[model samples]
Target: MYSTILCRTIECLTRDPSQNRKGDPGVTIYKIELLKLQETIPDLTRFLSDSECQRANRYHFIKDKNRFIICRALLKLLLAEYTALDISQISIEVDAHKKPYLPSHPSVYFNVSHSLDYAIIAIAENPVGVDLEYINKEFNYKEILPNVYHQKEMDEIEISKDKYLTFYKLWTRKEAVVKAIGKGIDNDLYKISVIDGSHTIPSSLVCNQKNLYVFSFMVNHNYIGALALTVPINNLDDILFQPLPR
Candidate 1:
């Protein structure tokens, strides 16, 4: 249970030139409410490339298609702001592991995750990964325990006052780390232990000889969010949360 912060939500389109400048040594998390952006779907597509549009069209459902467009559009807008480039100039490419990146601006690192009605984009000066999950209290989590949680994490959750929250806390942590490492979730998640015994502070771990720091927080009572970074967070203020205008 890392210390949680009440996200300081703000409009995603708000421009804070100083807060998110390229090379700024910090992270900013942008939240977008997909359900609120239904009318803007057409406008959002203007920010995406032809390939992105094609990918969105591949989704079987309109909701999923719109969600992908919203996520990518907001991502391009945010990156354009940080890189001081026109949104159309941003060319996003993915690595062999399928983690997205800006080929022209290697220094600007980011990751995006969405669940249900919302999506989050985390941008940092260094490599970063983020995860957002809607807490489904009624979902059966026992079947996933063995495949995803480490033995220690399973034990900790077994005795947790709220097993559902604990499950998500650790689950998001693992997902964030894998994203940060540019590895897909198909890896052995059970081998990753996020229980560092240090509550209230970012958990530090070494993966593939890379030092990673993870922080978990509540994105409101309904969603659990986590961030993984290649560098340690020097100040809590380094992480900013700005929710897009509904």
Candidate 2:
């Protein structure tokens, strides 16, 4: 599954952006460059249709465009085959509380996160949620901690030391799980405590809850990542990470 995941990432967004997805003519050039990158994912090439191009154009913001491009490209990459308009199509409509979802491919669950200059797209066989945050600035941990942590957790790490990274991981993990459930941060972050770091995800998370399992990890230097997999994993090695093709 991990190999398949990385292979899919490189194969789907096979083209490179001649120019970054920033600045003027950004949207148009980005679309063109990305579409060209489709060469990387030879197997999924059949899925990118002329109609999806028209649909991608509806977005005007660069961030929105980038996200959409990755989403669409990944959709084709994931299923790795021709799909009917209704089956392959992904239409995002917020949940009751405004959580985003693609009812079209309910099984092709995913979550995307952006932190500073990086974008993370985590896709799963079932509903999934992901989030990443950059900790480059000094933040008011004292002020924000109360919002997300339970009293017991606060007591667990009672030190005069800085746990900024710890806090970010906790925050991101909570956000990822809640988002995966389509409840967003509106749910209690404290109720769902999970430890995160460079390689390990807390044991509590590995245990199945209504069939969902979450794994958290770090990327690059400053970003913290957490993925909420709707279906529990038999092995952590099954999760994969792949950089987008240049």
Candidate 2 lDDT over 8-98, as tens digits, reads: 0001222344423333210010112234443454443334566665666678875565555655665444333212454345455556766
Report the Cα lDDT for candidate 2. 0.51
Candidate 1 Cα misplacement greater than 4 A, ranges: 1-25, 196-207, 237-239, 243-246
Query: Which one is best on lDDT?
Result: 1
lDDT of each: 0.76, 0.51
lDDT score for residue 211 of model 2: 40
- TM-score winner among the candidates? 1
Q: Give the range where candidate 2 is weakest over 10 consecutive residues by summed lDDT.
A: 1-10
Give the C-alpha miss distance for residue 112 in model 1, angstroms: 0.1
- Report residue 180 deviation for candidate 2 (angstroms): 1.5
Q: For candidate 1, give the lDDT of residue 164.
A: 91
